[model samples]
Target: MKKVSRGQRKQTKRFSLHSNSFKQVVKELSKTLVSGLVVAVASNFLLQFFQNQFNFEVAWLFMTEWHIELFILGIGVLMMLYIWFTSLIGNRYIGAFLIILISIILGISTQQKMLLREEPMYPSDFSMITNLPFLVKMMSNTIFLIVLILLIAISVSIFWLIKRARKGKKEKKSQHQKEVRGLRIGLFVLSSLSLIYIYAFNSPGNLVKAAYNDHAYWIPYSQEMNYYNNGFVGGFLYNLNVTPMEKPEKYSTEKMNQLLLKYEEKAKKINETRSKSLKDTNVIYVMSESFSDPTKLIDVKVSKDPMPILRQRMEKNKSGEILSEGYGGGTANIEFEALTGLSMEPFASNLSTPYTQIPSLMNHFPSAVSYFKDAGYSATAIHPYNTSMYKRKQVYQELGFDTFLDEKTMTYADTLEESPYISDHSAYQEVLLKLEETDETDFVHLVTMQNHMPYTDFYPETTFTAEGTADDLEAANYFQGLSYSDKALNQFLEELTTQEEKSIVVFWGDHLPSFYGEEVVTVNGKVAMHQTPLLIFSSEKEKQESLGTISPIYFMNHVLELANSPVSPYYAFLMTLEANLPAFEKGMYIETGEQESKLEREELSSETQQLLEEYDLLQYDITIGNRHAETANFFSSK
Candidate 1:
């Protein structure tokens, strides 16, 4: 006020400019951070909404849960870190783009998982992306359009945000630039470590375990329940960790030695008493897709018995119920149990498919193919579908198959009239060709694809319709498909019977078809939806004996037993286990003299418990444990 110099006035102006610049920077940061957090929250709500099938009550329940709030908070922290990191690099737009893109992908996956009742997308699922061209055909127009819109919107938003950020003038270098850089680096490292710890170990007192007690801990058994109990994000993070298989109680080299010795002694006795041999017989295993008889379903009535031939053959052949580990899907797990003679019940629940997780981890998998190869038979697998589906091409190679015939390679792969999948008739024709091509006794593993799911209006005309019930399109479509499968089965059997070569045809349904509604098949107060029909037939017309209900783990063992074929000590151990315990699937075991009682493993007798312990130890050693498998003849033909 007394005398203003030009220099002082210039200094005062500079201070004012600096203060405004700081305020503008703060405002921009706040806007970007808040927008990112909003996007994260909205995406989570959308995921829950879709996953719960737009059921407001279930969606609300998920949102109201305390654990879900923590999950949201975790997602927010991740978004904030991404935004902050991108902002530091002068490209906050990329962070926004990534957020939107990931949200879209997760949303679609959640919807699919809900529909399929399958586990969330794993690293292995990405290998199936090659089948997207065919898979996309199965999607509805509405879903396809919605996804398209989402992608377009995301692209526009990303472009707009990037343009806006670029339009803003860059801030001048600050006096504490080094400090800001150091802080940003420190925050990034800290956030990364926190995320890794949370996802890797389920930290913060193991929230997943706290939410779900011991019973619901296995995610693959009931993934839907897991998601409902734990929030989507929480459940996903919990399942991300693939824990090492726990060693059987008191497992050791000496313990394994004792079990091997006991089994070796039993094997010696069985081999000495063996009467028949499967040396020259061609073994054909047909895992028909969704080939269960709907007439066995209780709630709904069909117009006629869809599987008349199978029912008639059941009386004259060695046919029975197979307690499949999967329902509707999970063919790979069912095949794994059949091929390896190893029950998935003992492995980690998250190890959903061994073909994807186990075979890749192990140097060699001692499978039925390897066993047959050792016994002087060429093993070949045939699937009338994409070889890349479930990574089967790689799996078959590792499993030691001499040849694998897939959709691309199969000569007789022709689609059915009302279905996109290859017909069982055509698949059986390929089986005949393989039999003709190979002079040696071949182990032919055929997985049919005629009756795969999506029981929609694919059939222009329906031959069979649901009777004694309201009109249901899904049921009618399913029945028609089942009818086709039955006819194919009859034709295949006729061809097999006429063949001059002595062959054993093991036919079984992989699992029941997933119906649209809640009307599931049940038997004796227990859900029989997981059970499928199995038939073991011989072209030579051997004595037909009903095997009753059996677990898939004992499938190949029974095949060997019925053939009176020589088996290794490992198989002898399986025979003993199967003889003692009634056939059962995971989460339920049939007790020693109780055909109907389904009890937990803990409820078994002391002797049965010891046998189970030995089984678990041997399986662990052969699969997840050290290379002690070769130390004994557990997987050898000794």
Candidate 2:
């Protein structure tokens, strides 16, 4: 052994060097893989924690429940992103920096969305990318600062690691270079495989959905619970499996025509009973943002009644709660349903704002305003807020509104003492101007923004407070806002009575305020969680029978019936559906007097079941299917 030549000694040293280089490369790759796993878990927890209203108990459930398949899928996604970034930048630490940066943004958005929307962020939500600046404002300063600190810390640490790695000596033509290149190439290949396995282009055997089906528990109706049961990455991937609109299996032009023919006859019979017409009456829909009474909420105590005028009106007209599609936000969806008489429960569960989605696709979108516009009424939309809030400018144009008066264009732009938003009284002034400008029959769609979020110390007269809430000051402010809105409505209605023109004011709250904690859900029932006040006030008409709790899709039908105004065959069809089922919203179906929110299809009568099927068919025909129903004059008022 001691008789080795100098050449053999050199060869032995070279072999040892190569082996050491190989071990270093293997170690680096192993470390990278482990890092990806850790980030995946941490990111997933962050997302779930925020989505679940920052409840650590729910976040820890994932760790205890062994959501192994979802965790594996999440790891795959992060590794794929990491590998791509590392390969493109030629720096593993830089790749990590970018990955963490994206994770922070995504986590914050998910949290904010959960707070404002009472649901998880859908893939469709990102389509409203133009509203990013406004959407970002929804995040509280506390949350923003915490996220900023974490992000800056992560970025600096990674930058320092990158600089340190660059300072180390690396040979150009050494075994170390080859080893490094080989490891990166290997990781790149693995990431590619991971992406393909997780998603396979609409394949039923897709791993992302398959994992959810096998391991994760999810509800088709409740999106928030879906995010809770499945982790963030897992829930998002599961939602991705949804279609924008599934064409009904039995959908055909001939079938749509037959249903239209049947509904036309029913409309004729219904119209014969109506006394008055839409000749001189003005149809006005006032959507008060977050206008619900705080006293109705569990554990919320108000010093005095905030909505006396609304309560009085509710008792004297077709009034009750409206089952909202969203809990905390989604004003556009409620407005769309009220205007179009279309139920979102039947539409794909994942569809975002139909104001943008529906109008973008259809050339002939017949809405309540469209019908009124067709019948010699001037359609006017007034909102004392930014026109671009929900893409309302485009949507109002699509709805064939004649005059669109927003915050910038409105006559009255007065703000409350402490609030930055325009007052409801100012919003009502714009409507009065429209009425005075033209004596012709009018349809005004007014959305008020006075009661919008960030309700902190709004009014000096504020006397409302909550004992059990984490934030009593906020609750007090929100209740005070409702009182102000009530006063505005009272004054507006009195002014309407003084005017010569006969008008019908339909007022509703979009949804509950987002400040309510999860404890509210535990105290208040789920069905009650979605309830908001609804009233139809006619200048001349006296008290009518209560409409009871109903979905917004039935809103126009009830309005028409109350006004004794003739309705289109489409409205007649919706009225029939509403009769069978008074409220079907967001996934919960509530019978008029029933407290049981979840009603199974099996519990329905055969006739009601069949009518529901036909309802779905007709909606599909009008919205997603060819213009079979619309062309057949299914919406033409007799």
Global lDDT of each candidate = 0.72, 0.78
Residue ranges of candidate 2 with Cα displaced over 4 Å: 1-38, 52-64, 115-117, 127-137, 168-207, 249-254, 356-359, 362-365, 592-596
lDDT digits (tens) for residues 1-638 of candidate 2: 57999999999999999889979987877877777677666766666667766788877776556576666666667777787677666677787778777777777787888766677777656656787766656668898889879988997898888788768767567558777887788777777776666655235667556655778776766777777776787767765534546777777777877888898999999989987778788989998998886778778666788888788877877788888877788888888888887777777755666765555743465588878877799999998877776678888887788889988999899999899889999999889888998868999999999998888767766667666665778878888888889999999999999988888888999898888787886699777878899988888776667877888877778778767888888888888888878887755777545668755655666776787788778777777678777777777785
In terms of lDDT, model 1 sits at 0.72
User: Per-residue lDDT tens digits of candidate 1, residues 1-638?
Assistant: 69999999999988877676666656555766677677667666666666666566776666676455555554564465565556556455676667667656766766665655444545445556788886677556788798889889889988986788668667788654554455456555765765555565433466434544442333545556666565565555555656535777777888778788887888888878666666678889999887786666667678878888888888887888788877657788888888877787777665556777666643355567877888788789999988887888888888888899988899997877768888889999998998899878889999988877666775769877775323367778878888888898889889888888878888899887655334343332343667789898887775567777787777768677777777778888888898877476656677556756454677777777777888778878876676466566567654
**What are the runs in model 1 whose C-alpha is more than 4 Å off?**
1-32, 65-69, 72-94, 118-124, 140-199, 202-221, 361-363, 467-471, 521-526, 595-599
RMSD of each: 4.1, 4.1
What does the lDDT read for residue 398 in candidate 1? Answer: 82
Q: Give the TM-scores of the predictions, in the order they appear.
A: 0.87, 0.87
Residue pairs with colliding backbones in model 1 are: none
**In model 1, where is the ten-residue run with the lowest total lDDT?**
516-525
